[model samples]
Target: MNKKSCLNCGHTISDEFCPHCGQKSDTARITVHSLIKNDILGSIWHVEAKFLHTLKNIVFRPGKTGMDYIAGKRIRYNNFISLLLVLFGFNVLSYHYYEKFAPAQPLTDDVIYVKDFFSKYSKIILFVIIPMLAINAYSLFRRIKLNIAEHFIIGTVSLLGILILFLLSDIVSLIGLWKPVEKIFNIIDKIIFGLSILFPAITYWTAFKNSYSKPGLLWRVSVLYVLMGIETLIITAVLYEIF
Candidate 1:
């Protein structure tokens, strides 16, 4: 029955929260006690829970999650960059362990080379790979009616799913440090690596299977592979020139 402006967005409020921005209607001045109780205790838990929820959604149902985000169900989810940063941190830690605890027999030179290359250029490679794959998917899947930006989200989510599979494979490979388990882990690693290779195509097919007739979908996926190959070549050439 009383009118007040929301401190966050300066929107007029009549109830407990400002509907415009969802900030609490009764804004209070920051104090040490409030900071500890409300922000440190409350906000941290809220943020942590939200991040886990978002990660679960992204990992379990990337396509549906992407669609829901674009459709405005965004309050509970972190954006692509936030989750990517978390993944990047995970990669950094994994690489550190892989280096500090070197495998007993040492990996092949090709594997070492691949690891070094990605370690040095992962940030740059990520910027290129995610967007390029997104563009390719957007181009082929335009029938879904998502704008380029929306498709960008879908593309990145799909790629993020692929990244998770590879990261798990790499983590699994780490167990190979134990010689007795090394051979078995290596076999498991190869299987996971094989799955990672096909994950993108398989995920795309599954997402679009009902969106288009089988032949139509297959043709689009085929072109997507060609475009992805060309994109990879272009990125490699550019990165080679630079570093």
Candidate 2:
């Protein structure tokens, strides 16, 4: 059989990975190990190695990720929407399994779930349009020439930041510090709120850095970041709690 050519580049290699483009090589072999390694595990992840790598770095280095993304280092990271879908899907599956094993006590209070749902979901539904619109408005306000799509992309990246933190917060919860875990999450929630505002604000700054003359905008930027972040968190919590 003729060897498969690199989809990324014209180079060819005989293994499962391309030496030149680093793209995974697809073959006709059908083995159980290959199926597990390639189909189940690699399908979601290996499809975008660079993206996973970038995601790792971004998770560790909070503000710097967006900066790097906007600075044209995107090849190393999954596209904003793609990454969100993957991470969000992982969260959903995780919570589902967790709930399956350790179900939330049936709500004794009739208003509890409802109130929590609204408290979280309402903002998400409202902000479904706000972040994008806000970005467009801010872009126009600053006279920076970009598209609404850019706003969407920036909004997505900002949202991912929140998800990463939330996931980290979840990991922290398993350390057997339930009370402290709750407090830490509360604090992180506030911090995330701050960061959300900071997110778009920085995204704006980065997007419009060429035109904006402000030198030290981090403080004001942080305010917006936090507020918007809270909104994002509300939405995330709603979705998570529901499913």
Candidate with the greatest TM-score versus the true structure: 1
- Local distance difference test, each candidate: 0.77, 0.59
- Which ten residues in a row are the worst by lDDT in model 2? 168-177
Per model, how many backbone clashes are there? 0, 8
Predicted model with the maximum lDDT: 1
Task: Put down candidate 1 lDDT per residue, 1-243, tens digits, no spaces.
Answer: 989888889888999989998888767998999899888999998999988887777667766777788899898887776787787777678767876787456689988876677678877876676677678888788888777788677767766666676677768767887788999998998887787676667767766677999999889888987897888888877776676
What TM-score should be assigned to candidate 2?
A: 0.53
Clashing pairs in 1: none
lDDT of 2 by residue, 174-234 (tens): 3323565667656765675566444445545555455656754444455555655676676
lDDT of 1: 0.77
Least accurate 10 contiguous residues by lDDT in model 1? 198-207
